[model samples]
Target: MKRRKFLKNSSLSTAGIFSASLLASCETDKKPQVVNKMIKPIVIATWDVLNATNKAWQVLNNAGTALDAVEQGVMIEEADINNQSVGKGGRPDRDGNVTLDACIMDKDSNCGAVLYLKNIVHPISVARKVMEETPHVMLAGKGAELFAYQKGFKKENLLTEKSKAEWLEWKKTSKYQPVINIENHDTIGMLAIDSKGDIAGACTTSGMAYKIGGRVGDSPIIGAGLFVDNEVGGATATGVGEEVVRTVGSFLIVELMRQGKTPQEACEEGVKRIISKNNEKLDFQIGFIAINKKGETGGYCIQPGFTYRVYSEQGHINKTASSYISS
Candidate 1:
């Protein structure tokens, strides 16, 4: 009888221990799960266009969408009468016409563009409307103007008195030489990542000074002047748009990021591609700026004097030089 009682007690204790262990395991599993915290917003642009960057930062600061932030940011530059490479006071073409080109892209791969568009003060806004309202990816010339007018955008002369005077001066010389960043800044390419981590980009320009009428450069082309892939990153180009178009530079940088390269590495690769393809060496400069999904930024250029502006939580506004400048 004593031996049987001891065996029964041991079995009960064993059962109780196993039940306690199971209960503890269940409680642990029921604990709340943790989610990843969102990173702060970032704004980056091709030039030290701090005014535009600050405008973009306001959108991001207010928790606005990335697409809206990029559009609003570049629009500031587009409206600045002092800025000769973009917006209202931009340089005229060889025919004394103020034609504009612009493109916008979102994380969902939706993009829109307008090329050779005339008499529109804000081409970036028109590009956004095209992306949101139309099925087609691009509209050009009078068609773009019609669309802009239909969409309630005012039709006004884009050329300013200062621009006209400069055009007259150029006519006297008839020289086509373009000094980088002075006469040939080409475009303002802006990229932004909102608080929600969504990415978008915009590129707007009056194209090359003295370019032939109806000339469209990389600024209006999605993969060339601007590209955005939310999962990977975004990139934009400036300087010589033709060189950028030939290499599909912005798209190449995004792909490089997807392939695990850093933003700097990707931008450098874009510059190298341009160099390799133009074996005869380019007479003009070409530059690329990129921002990764993590909000890290980088830039590279074929010639010296290329710079970019970056804004992030860690830094307010940083003016950084490109990685490479040809000798």
Candidate 2:
């Protein structure tokens, strides 16, 4: 009988030990998995565009949102009186009016844009307000200006003395022919991914130099000049806006990425699409830059001399050539 009792007691003790060990193991397994915390943020912009990357990097480093970073970054170029392609100092239309076009997009698919908006100094900011405060996707011309005024944006003449002088010179001959990257570099498109992995993009321009009055380009049109999808990536365009608009270049890049192509491949495909569809080979430049959710970046252009700037923890102010540059 004592032996039987001893056997039973030992069995209970062993079972209890096993149960305790099992419980401890289960608790250990249930502990949350630690994710790598060293993922860096990314910023990319079309062309060098002055110190725009620095401005964007500052925002991302300070934990600001991606939307804020892109807007702040491109605004530097917009306000730069020397950059004839964008913002206040941008080249004017044939009518000598410096009209602006801009668009902003966020990961949530919210987007806003303004086209042929005159007198406003920062059309990008106006675009942001349109995205956030209004139900419409776009505002144009006088209506856009009125919205800017209501939003407390001051009206300022966008044309600088230098830009005006250039316009007057162009009027001497009234030559409408524009060289690639000289008179037709139409936008400063910026894309950024914040520390939290959210993506956003912005594209702003003064429209094509010496374009007819009231002409709008792809810069203010979502999916053409800019597109952002947090689940995939973001893309933006520069150069001839008409080709980009027809191909929906930026949107095509993101969708290509969704199909598992790398950023470079997607961008090249975008450029190729334009080549295939156009009746004649493009004589002007058209370029695209894209960044995936993984922070990979790539760009491609129809003509040579196209470059883009990137900022990240790995390095700041890195400039890279496009994968394909037309001969």
RMSD, model 2, all Cα superposed?
A: 10.1
Lowest lDDT 10-residue stretch of candidate 2: 174-183
RMSD, candidate 1, Å:
10.6
Native-to-model Cα distance after best TM-score fit, residue 10 in candidate 2, in Å: 58
Tell me the TM-score of each prediction against the true structure.
0.86, 0.86
Model 2 segments beyond 4 Å from truth?
Answer: 1-38, 175-183, 323-327
Candidate 2: tens digits of C-alpha lDDT, residues 170-193: 888866654334446847999999
Q: Which residue pairs in model 2 clash with each other? A: none
Clashes of each: 0, 0
The total of clashing pairs for model 1 equals 0
Superposed on all Cα atoms, the candidates' RMSDs to the truth, in angstroms, are 10.6, 10.1
lDDT of each: 0.87, 0.88
